[model samples]
Target: MSEQQKGPAGGGPGGQRPGGPAPGNFGFGPGRGGPGAMGMPVQKAKDFKGTLRRLTGYLRPYRFSLLIVILTAVLSTVFSIVGPKIMGKATTKLFEGLMGKIKGTPGAKIDFHYIWEILAVLGILYIISALFSYIQQYVMAGVAQKTVYGLRKDVNEKLARLPLKFFDSRTHGEILSRAVNDVDNISGTLQQSLTQIITSVVTLIGVVVMMLTISPLMTLISIVTLPLSFVAIKMIAKRSQLYFKGQQKALGELNGHVEEMYTGHNIVKAFGHERKSVDKFNSVNEELYQSGWRAQFVSGMIMPIMGFIGNIGYVLVSVAGGILVLHKTITIGDVQAFISYSRQFTMPITQTAQIANILQSTVASAERIFELLDEKEEVPEAATPIAVVQKESEAVPGKAIKARGDVSFNHVQFRYKEDTSLIEDMDIHVHSGQTIAIVGPTGAGKTTLINLLMRFYEINNGSITIDGVGITQLKRGDLRNLFGMVLQDTWLFNGTIRDNIAYGRTGATEEEVVAAARAAYADHFIRTLPEGYDTVLNEEASNISQGQKQLLTIARAILANPTILILDEATSSVDTRTEIHIQRAMNELMQGRTSFVIAHRLSTIRDADLILVMNHGTVIEQGTHEELLAAGGFYADLYESQFSSRKRQVDAV
Candidate 1:
């Protein structure tokens, strides 16, 4: 029967929107240095305490080791802090002895023996401090690495569970940035900044305690500079935070541009858009440069500003201590020690200020990583999954029923977005063994239909069934195992030809792989290669011809050997002679299987048992090829147009 239907549909050619942004857009609109274009949005953690708590959960497993690291950091800082005070004692002893000797008093010689003892003690303390510092670093390294290992593992697992819609909405580079750059930033902060924070706090506390013992007045002088130091830090850090966030966003955009342009270099050159591409790159690069230097310059100001504040404190303490020593209110040794503690005091404050600045960037990175981990995942599997059993031969009397390849779509409705209703009230059925060819114009929802069948995107309403069981009742993995697919865009990893073919069926034997290749008419050409079946495909499989890649994918599908087969323009890239051979091999493979073919070349499916004509998103006509041609409808017009176009091209040649 033939039918006609009308609906509102909006997808463009090849299931993409027509008149969409160009590839150079990179998901960021024009005005490269504009507010949003200058950088990616920084996602601040909603609850800093909660995020820190979650991050610390990863550290709980190694708490004992971390405790030892903390202890070592404390010991190292304490030992270093005590050294300056002890050295001051030796300084006072020498000064007293020199004054006595210059006055020519009896038994007034300098105490070389006491000085040697102090020097020996100071040397031992330095060595002990260094040893403890090394130990703290070693232990913290292991803890930091282990924590990030768990984080990276969780992110990867979360990626596998996420639905296809999540991927469709994001650029590949954005996802990769989260996985690589964001996680790495967390790792670096844990490894270095965590330890710095611990040491700075401990050193600050120990120096303050020692300084009080030497001269409380001198300590008060040192404390007066704190407000000025904090004010400078607060102002500079506030400004730098904005630039740092901008720097990260610009970096991600630049990375996205590089990845997209390099992957599609051939297309850009073919369209003579190289100059345009270069201009896009320059725009992004300039934004990155401006943000990066501003961030560095602002952060760089912190050290010097803190240093100036520290020197002001140092000179004040020194002058006050010197006056007190002259009045005999404090020993020269005490004054010397107070000056050393004053210097030590400001060092930790400066370091702590810098650490605060570093943490801003670190938190921004962690937020990005957490965002990816929190994406909505695919629908959960059935609580009670049904098994799919495919029967190869006559069924045994007591065995489970076999999957017969009968499929049905009942009142299905779907849309990519809320505004676009692409499919509505669609109904279809196929017998156990039938060849159904689907024909449609560009953007007619051809690929969308295949996506629903495979459950890549769930239908908004209705149900699809395999045999007599609804697909939702079956585990997605089990449902997918029942079908074999070959698409127009071939996907091959960076591996040998043999490895690519064997990927169809896990643990497939070498002989089986070879047989599959031969059946697809790919074995002869593979043998002619320099490395035969061992020839390696580069990234994107560019080392091989497009026809060869298509053939290899067919071989992969043949090896899968499912009860149902789906081929979407599978042979569109091959030559006429190669197409003939592929058609013969596919015919053999489709002997007893249910086959669904989608083709733009109407000639390819003339022999199909059923031909489906679709427009917009509805199935308008269904019948044998001859029956549709006699009806003089949409199918007839489509067939005639393609036929005439091909004839004109051939005649011209």
Candidate 2:
């Protein structure tokens, strides 16, 4: 990594802080404090269509259902208008029938029948509207679920293809939030928003049409208030979008903190920094709280305010209609229908306010999810990649394993994301079954060599070849499987002991798992555990000791039994007795495989076939232990310091 990256963003395994949006993170920005009350204003909110258009691609497969849902909502709204109109007709005819019946006038005998027919029509309209609503909701929910399923699947597949550098650059919390929380928010919104938005729109249009049919003059009077509502809605939408974006970003930050604390709880407790940790958590939690309140407060005002404005329109319609009646300019039925039409305007306006709040949240979540999927992935392959080996047998276990353990670095010079090389003009070769120890003072490119060999980072110059092929020519996944690595840091998944051991060769039998455990000297401790081989190691193997965790990792590699192994100071963290046992296990595992050991303990690598003493980027000394001791170079001095220290400790004992 670059020097800039080395300190912040993400540290490393144990120190990896995970990911959250930064404090000023309303939108993805170069700098951090986004707004407080305002949602994180997207960098380019006006250009959100591109993201929206892309998100709509997930729903493309459900286009037919989408159409059906929309049409049903519109049809339901249109049919709903028929209900109120029918009721008005029944009321008008019943009143006229009373006057005619009192005088025994003509058409009075049939007026009662007409009223019943009108009432029946209203009942039919109500039933049809309810049925359409049911179909629309059911179909919309199904479409939403299917769309979310497709979206989740695509995001997962894309994430899997991203290079290790991507993870190196971002925190685990950010990625986790995108996978679970962000995707979940989107799914919930889609389930109902698609129908609700359509229903609200169709109902508004239907109401406007019915109001015009009753009287255009009264409709105009009611709709003048429409302009004021529109302005209010747009203003609120802009403000709410900012806060909702802040809420989501805050939640992402909070998630990152929780992930870090949970993973490093032991470290915090051991360091006696409980108060410090709690204070940090509270600060993040408070930011989340503030963002949620601001977003909710802005969105919550829309519904009630729209209702108030719509009510004013309703009152105006009633007053105007009473005047028209006094002047004998319109019938009582016209006045009654106009009042009902005024109600139509008010109800839809209220619904619009409710739908707008939901729509803002949906947009915010969609924006965040799209941002992740669009992250630049490293190591993209050809549309039709060349396959060096394609045999089905190559994928199978024992038959698939190889012994071509030769690894050579020819004039290899590397730098981690910089021009100055960490390992310059370095040439090394490991023949099959050779035990090569790479020793150096601190900051002498020890880890960098292994990283280059593992292809975790690319060399700026020179070639690294394994088994007569340039490492770049090989598929990364296939190449890594050939080498078993045991690092000082043990990262075990939450699964059965057998599951963790057989993770590489997933189809390996239970017997293979136990055999590998026994070889690594891990079986004794594992058997003593509550469930033994069936035991689950939750979150970094919390239930086990550090020594046992390292042992289990060794057992995992032992089961794979690669032709080459990297024992990266695997025994560094254990006690003397445990280290000895681990060393013994390492010897057994490395017997027929090429191995590279990076160790701080000078005693451990003394018996290695070749010991290359490194200083800065160059190998200062190279030979057997006796050969180095005779030369009286850097290794001799390092050995003398440890050797004298051990003598003093033994004397004290």
Candidate 3:
């Protein structure tokens, strides 16, 4: 891969986790970098209203559950809000009784019964409030998961439908960041922030109403300081935002540097670049520390400063309430209740401020997800597919019986970009049961030809056909099922060897899997492993040698039993001895089947029925090996060059 294709060292910024203080410590439920996270950089969507509306559509299916969540949240906050006022009545009764008793009045006795009843009522109210809160959380949790489940499912389906160019144009990390990290951001916001926003707003309004009923003058005094809290938050957030962005960027750089260094540590050590690598790591690490701490410090000032301002308001409300009590305008109980309301007032105000930032980031994440979901999918599949017959008499089971591997590309024109042509007026016709070899240098559009053949890309003009039926007339799945491919790079998932091989065919019996392995000369290696066919391949299949992995992929292709075989440098990774054995096995597999062999080693295609020498995406010469050499053309020159290179190697040995 080129440096451009590998992308940056730290993956991408969206994929990195925070490298400093845990976001949860700031009262954010998770490191969502969204609501209630003060220092985290806010990310606003380009189309905030549109993205938010689309995000809301995900919740449409759970409208009933959301209704329940909203009702429960409102009920819970209202119950809790009314508690402080009702308890104040008990306080007033106690105060009046004490004053009477001090004067030695006969009837002046503390009302223990009334006080006890008040306590019981308060406990029940709290219990009901707790129950409603629990119900809200439960219902919202379900709604959040189901909503995201649908969104994730849509993203997954979109990925499969996307053309190869879509993946080629972006880094793997970038795609994964949008699909996984961005989707997770939306999920976290839906699960926690959505409900919290509702409750905070409700609590703020309810607290004000209750406070007003106690003492309007005190309520006014308490709320007058609210703007100070907002101002402090705005000032702090504005200053800290830059550092938070720096912290995120620096963290991504550090992560990418570390990952790149670790993955290529062997090369680094061999080249004695350890010191340089360490110096680079230290540089990025230092940047992360600088930005992280600065963001934390600036954001940390918010709570203390908000508290200081809140304390001033508290002092003012207390003095005002005391004067009112003395003037007999309000009871002592009203003073106590009003003070509680004042304290409660500041919490939601702070929460509201924090949540505003969070919603912006959350909307940004949603916009990214929506962009992916809205990407144009592979040109829609054929609405009415032409059915192809399957015949057991075909050379291989499950082969394309109608075509017998007859393929023709008619005056095909293609270009990856509009400004440059890759393949122009390309034409090829392969007869059934013939071995056709495609020889070309690197970047000569060799792989691109195969990609076009399989419809991984669509041609700009002309058509590809199988047995006179246009390829586009069949469903993509049907078109691809006609051929089997073995490329230089082998791909195998983390699974038992048997399962990986069986992946080529649905419901393939264990007997057929072993037989296919034997045909590819892979059975000997399989039996040598500790668990044989049951041995599980680790991620990357690193437990096996490169040659063995290639053999396994060959076995998978053999099991597919396709009539049109594509061998793209299939034996490039094996030793000469192994290559000879594989060549013989492939020769037998290719009998009565059309095969397209792409190889740089001229010796491998010497026996090909028809050899096409390609250059600059156009075929320079085409003929049988003996006929091509007799013609003394481009094919002859390419073959002679490889032969002379091999003779030199032999002479040196």
Clashes of each: 1, 6, 3
Kindly give the stretch of ten consecutive residues in candidate 2 with the minimal lDDT sum.
1-10
Reference-based TM-score of each model: 0.84, 0.81, 0.92
Model 1 stretches with alpha carbons more than 4 Å out:
1-43, 61-63, 110-113, 116-124, 231-301, 388-401, 417-420, 648-653
Residue range 97-141, candidate 1, lDDT tens digits: 998989988999789899999999999999999999999999999
Ranking by TM-score: 3, 1, 2
lDDT of 3 at 602: 87
Give the per-residue lDDT digits (tens) of candidate 2, residues 493-559.
7788778778746578888889989998999998998888899988557788888877777888887
Count clashing pairs, candidate 3: 3
Local distance difference test scores for all models? 0.79, 0.73, 0.81
How many residue pairs of model 1 clash at the backbone? 1
**Model 3 residue pairs with clashes:** 9-256, 10-256, 35-358
User: Which regions in candidate 3 have their CA more than 4 angstroms from the true location?
Assistant: 1-31, 34-36, 388-403
- C-alpha lDDT (0 to 100) for residue 565 of candidate 2: 82
Better of 1 and 3 by lDDT: 3
Candidate 2 structure, TM-score to reference: 0.81
